[model samples]
Target: MTWINDIKHTLNKKCAGLAACALVLALAGAPVLAPAQALADVRKADVVYGQAVDARGLSVAQCPSIDAEYAFVMDKDGTVYFERNATSPTQIASITKIMTAVVALDAVASGAATLDSTVTVSAAAAAVGESSADLQEGDTMPLEVALKALLVPSGNDAAVAIAETIGGSEDAFVAAMNAKAAELGCIDTVFENPHGLDDGEFAGDQHSCAADVAKMAQYAMKNDTFRAIVGGGDTAIVVNRADGTKPTIELESTDELMDYYSNAIGIKTGFTALAGPSFAGAANNGDKELYAVVIHSTSEAQRFEDARELFDWVYEHELDYRLANSAQTATMTVNGARTEVPVAAEVPHTEWIDKTVKATLADPEASVRIFDLNGNVSQSLEFDEVTGDVKAGDKVGTVTFKQRNATIATVDLVACEDVAAPDLLEGIGIWWDRLFRGLSGQPQVASAVTLNETPLVVDKTAVAA
Candidate 1:
């Protein structure tokens, strides 16, 4: 009793008008003292990355050192994993065929054209000197057959045929290609021709970067038709002509990566003096698939080497979600009273216990980017002042994880415990907490009940006799 009296005496002297005894009675269950004014500002947790910051001591996959002037890697979801000189645009060589193939495929997808539709090879298409499909002028074959010629052999002639047949001209096809690249957010890309030939009059201007090329590859592979075509590396098929005569042609993949690498998939290859050597390729292992780009490598073989080195490593090492690092219970301010909420995912993160790199499924500051592969995934904090009662597991805020500014995952911040509405006395305590914190230069944010300040009566009922 003596000690309590002494404490009351000291509080009365410090807070001249606080009415210390009254405050103690009102705030018996009040939250810890913080200035309610501080709630006006937002609070964010530090989003830590790297091996040392991992909640669980799991060794992450190491990044491979690639030797190429331009290189980029991404997952199947267009999440860029890594890049070197990815922003600088350079002549893409045969990687240009990806856009050509996409436009042609879009035509088929939209019912504007079909695989069985005839494409009459003109002198422009047939007379292509570099990497020809061996198509003769005036020959007519299925558009599907021409695409095989274009993609498998990396034929400039097939590009011309697709452009002329589908787009009605090469210039128009190039325009469409540029439009598609722009639409896909390829800011540093420009298509001056359907074929990635640097030997043309505008050789220097026809270029793309590793990042842009990765986007094109990702968009193309999502389609079943395009995926099947590229996945089937080398094939021999009979191409029927308009006259009913069918000629058998042997189509070989120009991308050697598919030939030597176990799970390598076909994409496109390019080379010319200005562009050096380039390849946009893909690979798959189990459930993971990646799109890789290497441009301006020292030699043609070096491009494949760089791609394989990246693909094999990325596919083998993937990040998985583990348990939440933070506690399951969380506190929220409601109606001037403190409430608790329970949080959980549909499946316990422990399911990924067997994974190599375990990440948090709950309260993750940032989405694990899967080593250096899925570009950068980050989240913005969402904290707004809350009032009124709340139920357990009720959503309060969110941590939105994004890649390339596109939302990939959103973790709902929910209540782990219930917060009941405050009565009139509690409301006085809340307003008093805010007023005290304001006078003391502290955030009026409530954590636990404190009896240091006199209760404020925001409503008349708070002081009713």
Candidate 2:
């Protein structure tokens, strides 16, 4: 959604770029284009539940056999799940563009430029080409469109243009890229050019590794604009020439992971005689999201397959533990009501409890332990202060489940039944009784409820004792 606004703002500034073209093409009965088509293949994975596993003692025998020279699989939060030669420094080729995108977007966030800001393709940039975004020398386009060209097609030219626009020159931009890598704790990463080209004048001692690339991917994916652009399959972009000619350039995604894996999220792909075929792939299976980076794979298609194997292996073997169930009740005191009311999960459970046994509510606590394949998870409960009338199923609080400080889910806590305020006469009577009790030096009793105060007793029927 944020990316949508970013694209719209940029397009609106440049004569309604995509949206306007879509309309014109539609009226003329040409192929209609929508930006969202880029994410058409992405969908949430079905929930898969499994018992917890103690991954600390996980054996190498259980790991997937991948074909890459170097590989790393990590959670979005930077938790490493699998690695092979992950720290070995090697030429990463165009995967270096990931950092290039990060630096450019960082400038946008810092107000140095905007998505609508124009970038001129210098002759030096357009001439330093390999994989192209169809940008020609002196051609100009918005930073947003340029990013699609840079990322989707792994455009070397677009990367140079962006670096010059954002960092003033390729040398300066490369310095910024290195600084960003250092800032992100990427020890083995070094950048020589914005395009990640490893030949000619662009070539140097530049290199990175699977571990460092994964770190960059994790950081870059936080930017919605960056994520949308990489995941966007193929798109048409409009660029302007000084002579007043506007040409639409169609950029096709180099990433082929979506062809076989439905949950594949676009990140980046690269190939060079030196770096071989490399891919930084991402996927979200239900609530779990992971990033897999493979460098120097046997082939371009094989790189994607390697990532697929990593993802499939993780989902099949890793745990998706159930952390907490809301079917249980909580007790809370309503200040102006007759007594404390019981609260349960706003969402109902299919399993039924005992009919005869009274299930008294207790103080809210996280009694269940659930594990995500990535790591351990903890929970925190927050409840609203209550007063006056309350209705059944009214939201009263929230139960947040977190894994390694990252929120996994938040479920609403709701009242199980109603609690009404006392009538005027009854209120007066209660106040009088309280005053009498206070004068008599008698300790007042506040109403309370407990779920554990009564234990369940089961024979033929399940009920609380």
For model 2, residues 235-309, the per-residue Cα lDDT tens digits are 889999867899988776777787568888889887777888889999988767889999888776678888998
Off by more than 4 A, model 2: 1-61, 322-465
TM-score, cand. 2 vs. native: 0.61
Candidate 1's TM-score reads: 0.61
Worst 10 residues of 1 by lDDT: 39-48
lDDT of all predictions, in order shown? Answer: 0.65, 0.70
Clashing pairs in 2: 361-450, 361-451, 362-451
TM-scores of the candidates are 0.61, 0.61
Best by the lDDT measure: 2
Cα lDDT, model 2, residue 29 = 60
